[model samples]
Target: MTYTEAAEYILNIPKFTTKNKPEHTRAFLSFLGEPQERVKVLHAAGTNGKGSVCAYLHAMLLAQGKTAGLFTSPHLVKINERIVINRDQISDDAFLDIFEFVLGKVKEMEAEGLPHPTFFEFLFGMAVTAFASAGVEYAVLETGLGGRLDATNSVQHPLVTAITSIGLDHTAILGDTLAAIAFEKAGIIKPGVPVFYADTTEESNRVIEQRAAELGTPCKKIGKDAYEILGIRDKHIAFSCVNAYYGNTTWSLNNIGIYQPGNAVLALEIMRFVFGEEGRPDLWREALHELKWEGRMEEVLKDVYVDGAHNVSAVEGFLRSLPEKEANIILFSAVNDKDYEEMIACLCRNVDTDFYIITRIEDKRAAHTKELQHIFETYTDKPVFVRESLEEAIDFALEHQHGRKIYCLGSLYLAGMMKGYCNSGEQ
Candidate 1:
């Protein structure tokens, strides 16, 4: 199949299926000769910050002169962004070739009465296959959903596993309570594998600790005390770490959010655990200072910022990490499944936005603009605008921007759609 046809095939399949079994992935991988088994994996899972943590790990690994692969989910733009080797996305030619090969394997499985893989599972398989073909030494995997039943967990072994800050997300499937969500995220911790996690809420910490102890796994909790913050300003952070492997050496990341320092620490701890203290501090400094993971805290225009803060915790971080300057307007959208009520409340209560524009995004899961505006009304009495089109939303936000900042947030789908518009010079 051609690239377009392959994409159509994958996208046509249900985004998520009720059956989240790993057996389908196992069977499919076996048919493809078990490519994931060939590479050393670094499995990461969490409700938020998994993508940034994986991006940091990929950057640091490459800086150490090692071949690394990155597999992330819900691409902001193209599907190729989800699969990368040596910092480059899979090319159209390579994607088409892999799709054709994997299709053959799928047919073989279907003939044997095996079930088909979901959209996430198929993409993850392609990433594993591509990584194996490239002979990457390490593959940094970001779990699509909860860790326990995630397709990425099909990988038998990883050099080390990390569970970043866990919060209440995917409450319908993963569970509603923080402890229940933490239990799901902790599923990546394997027997005897060294696990590292962010020192987050007490509920999450207890769940993760208990899971690790049950498996006799050596677990380390990287808390605030493990790192000393030197400065936080201008959407950048500088910190020094006193963790077990890392000395109290100072490091800084430019053009990133305040919440990123913790994620960076998690990635650094993983690198230290796997490759030892041989990594030069200079390479790390250069790499992190220039690290770019789109749609997190990306500035699409001169004074406008866009973020994908769809959930409550992420929205809280976005609001907390904002510069002290007041924002002129906030354009937002979120899928129906998310807790947009709490997200809206957080943004309204924290940041003083003169205008709030609720817009529709390019996703079936998106909450309607009217519905979102109604929810926002309950929290804030600010002037709220509704626009069905993203371009119109941008226009409205800019028209109301009186020299203050225009912040677009709420959903990654919205962020991606806005990024595309901005790149096309349509802003």
Candidate 2:
């Protein structure tokens, strides 16, 4: 099969439950020789920031001259972006070659009456197989959804497991409260394994700590055991590490947001914990600045900041990163299942921001601009322009932005789409 054909085949995979029975991923991986066991893994699970954390970890490892494999989900532009080696997306030849090889085995399994794997499970199997065959020294796997039953959890002997901040996301699967969500995030913690806990909510932290105690894993909090961001200036962030293997060293993070310090510190701690003194601080510093985490508080164009702050907690972090009450306009859109009201409401209360609500295309989950317009009327009498697509949204915001900054938020999918548009247009 060609890469395009292989991609089409995988897209037909059905998403299944977040349950404990790993029958699907197990069967798929077993057919592929369980290659996930071949490399050192830094498995990460959380409601938000998993992708960002994975990118940071991959970058750090690559800087140390280690060949790292990165597996993320729901690509913004290209499907191959979901599986990367040393910061580069998988190539056409490799993708097609693996897909054809895997396809034959999948057919054989089905011929023998084995249950077919879901889209995510099949991809997981393919990625691990590819990484193993490619001789990846390390693999950073991001959870597709909730942790415990996530297909990526099938790996054993993870070098370190880290949880980004826990919050109310995937409530139907992860549960209602912060504690319930934390339980799902905590599912990644295995007995005797070291876990990195970022600066999360106190409530979520308690739940995680309880789980760690039960599992007999040492859960080290980033701010307490490791270090965190001491301060931030325009385009520069200062970070320090204490319990980290890199020791008490501080450096500049080229990323724009202060929230990244948590992920940065967590990455350093995980790297040090996994590699100890062999861990290089210089590599960590170089990678932190050079890391390209798309749609996570990224500035894709001139004076325009894009973030996939789909959930309430993410929105809060994004808002916290912005300057105080500097009047501006927020160009936003969201998927239907997200807490758009709470997210937009939080932004409204926090910033002197106006709204230019846009409707994302193609995805059935997208919320309509009319719905957002109605919600905005209840919150503020500020001007709200409606657009059908991201291009129209960008143009509208730029036309009226004048000296004000443009913030595109609410959905990561939309951010990806806008990024592609900007990239193609040379913006």
Candidate 3:
């Protein structure tokens, strides 16, 4: 089958079957020869910044001259973006080869009356299998959802685990309160494996500490105090860690997001654990200075950027990272499952935007453009425009910029569509 057809088959699996139990995932991995066991895996989980943390780890591993694989979620552009080795996405031929093999396994399972893997599970299996075949020395795995029962959690052993900032997301499945959500994220902690986490809140930190204690694992918390932002200049944000080993040296990231320093520091601490005295902070510094994570305040066009900040907490971070009191134009869209109203309210209250444009993402769960427009109209006196088509919304935002920057945000799907449009040279 063609690569497109193979991807379609995996995407359609979600429509027919629900997520299987953890045992099912473990058993499937076993059937696939437990490829995860062949590599030193670094598992990362949290509400936000987990993907960034994984990217940082992968970059650090590469800087150290180790072959690394990165498995992330909600690819901003293509399915190949979800799996990368040595900074390159898996080739279409490689993807189809693995897809056909996994498809055969799924058929065998069906013949034995076993449930087929869900969309995420099938992809996770493919990532590990590909990593194993390539003989990568390390693999960075990001949890798809809440960590405890996530398909990625089937990897019973990992060299280390890290948890990024925790917040109220996936409230129905994970939990509503911060502590409840923290418990789910902390489930990634395994006995004797050291875990590092971003110290987001007192309540959440307490839950993670308790979980680590119960598992008899060493847990280190990296708080905001661990690093201080120096400044943002020339499309880069510079920060200095409090760790004296760095000797007050400032580290800069290619992207200007304010929250990235925290994510970078979390990855730095994990690398310290893994590499000890042999860890080359200089190499890591250079790697981060050159790294650019797509869809996180990524500038797709001149002064036109897209961010994947669909949840309330991520929106808060996005607001914090924006230039204070600068008038901007926001092109926003979100899925129905998100708290888009609260996200809108937060953006309207905090940001000095010239106006707001609302559009719908290309997803079955996308919120209607009219609904988003009404919500924006309620929150701010700023002119709210509705465009049923994302392309029209982009055009309107650009024409109405009036020298103000344009930020398209609210959903990864929206970011993906915008990036695809920009890359297609249609913008």
Candidate 4:
């Protein structure tokens, strides 16, 4: 099948919601000759900062003259962006080659009476094969959802396992409470593995601590063991890494956000563990200078910023990271069934900018404009109205907006659509 056809075929399959076991992935890998064991994996799992932490770790790995493989989900612009190696996407030729190989193996599985691999399972297998084929030294993986039974968890060994701040997201699948969610994320930890965690609520920390104890893993949590602060004007952030293999040094951050201190320290801590003391410091400086995490607190254009903050924790981070002031924002959103109303309320309360709500073109779960308007009304009767299309929404914001700082908030699909408007080939 062609690339587009392959993507559509993957999407058409019915989703398998339960985290039954890792056997599905294992079976598929066996069929493909077990390509997963060839690379060193750095696995990251959490609610808010998975993308940023993965980006940072991948960048640092590349700077150390190693071929790094990055696997993320729900692409902001192009499907190829989800699977990158050495800061470049897996090309059409490479994508097609491995997919066909995996599909053939999948058909063999079905013939042998095994269950069909789910969409995420297929993606995970493809990622493992691609990384092996490219001979990458390190594969930086971000879990698609919760961790306990995530398709990517078949890798019981990783150089380092990081758990970003746990928060209430994917509540139905993960659990209702932060502690429950932390337990799911902690699934990536194994015996003797060094765990790097960022700032988590006290309740969440208890759950993580329990899991680490059960696994017999030594953990270094960001805010608890190491910490950072934003420099003058927040153009830079600094962190002291006492727990890190790097010497006790205060790092100056290139990503501008007060909320970044947690993820920032987590990334540094991973580098310190991955490399020895000297390599950690050098890689840290190089990666921070070249860090580019799109859709999650990213500056896409000269004056416009975009963030895919689809849940309460991410929304809170977006608001906390930015200057507290009212500005015009081009907002487009699409969330899972569980988070729509709460996400709307969080956006309206903390992000008090002029919002232009746009409708998503393709995704089925997108909320209608009238429904969004009603939610906005519940927060305030202010005229942060809706637009029919993404172009119209951007046009509305551009026409009414007065200053250099432009912002876009809400879902990854929204960020992808607006990224279409920016019209750049890069993600």
Best-matching candidate per TM-score:
3
Tens-place lDDT per residue, model 2, 1-427, is 5677889888866553223366666777788887888989899998877888888889888888899999998788888988898867899899888787777878888898777777787788778888999999899999998888889888867988999988887787789899999998888898889899876778999988999999899988876445566776766678676643455667667666757777777777787777776878777787787666788767787788888888998888887788675438788888888878987788777788765565665578889889987787777777777888777777777887777788888887888888888889844
Which segments of model 4 are wrong by more than 4 Å?
Answer: 15-20, 232-254, 278-280, 354-358, 424-427
Instruction: Report the candidate with higher TM-score, 3 versus 4.
Output: 3
TM-score of every candidate: 0.96, 0.94, 0.99, 0.91
lDDT tens per residue, model 4, 1-427? 7988887776665564333368777777889887778999999999988888888888888887789899999787777788898879999878888889888998898899888888788888888899999999899999998987888888878888999988898888899999889999998888888888876788988777788888889987777546645362444556555654556565665656556767776887787677764574666675776576667666666657778877888877777777665445646556546476787777667655655455654477776777777777788655766777777776666676677466777677888877777875432
Model 3 / residue 193 / CA error / Å: 0.6
Candidate 1 yields a Cα-based lDDT of 0.87
Candidate 1 shows a clash count of: 0
* Local lDDT at 218 for model 2: 90
By lDDT, the best candidate is: 3
Candidate 1 weakest lDDT stretch, 10 residues: 15-24
Which has the higher lDDT value, candidate number 1 or candidate number 4? 1
Q: Residue by residue across 61-149, what tens digits does model 1's lDDT show?
A: 89989999999988987899999999799999999998888878888887998877788888998999999999999999999999998
TM-score of 4: 0.91
Q: Which pairs, if any, clash in model 2?
A: none
Please identify model 3 stretches exceeding 4 Å from their true place. none
Deviation from native of the Cα of residue 392 in model 3, angstroms: 0.3
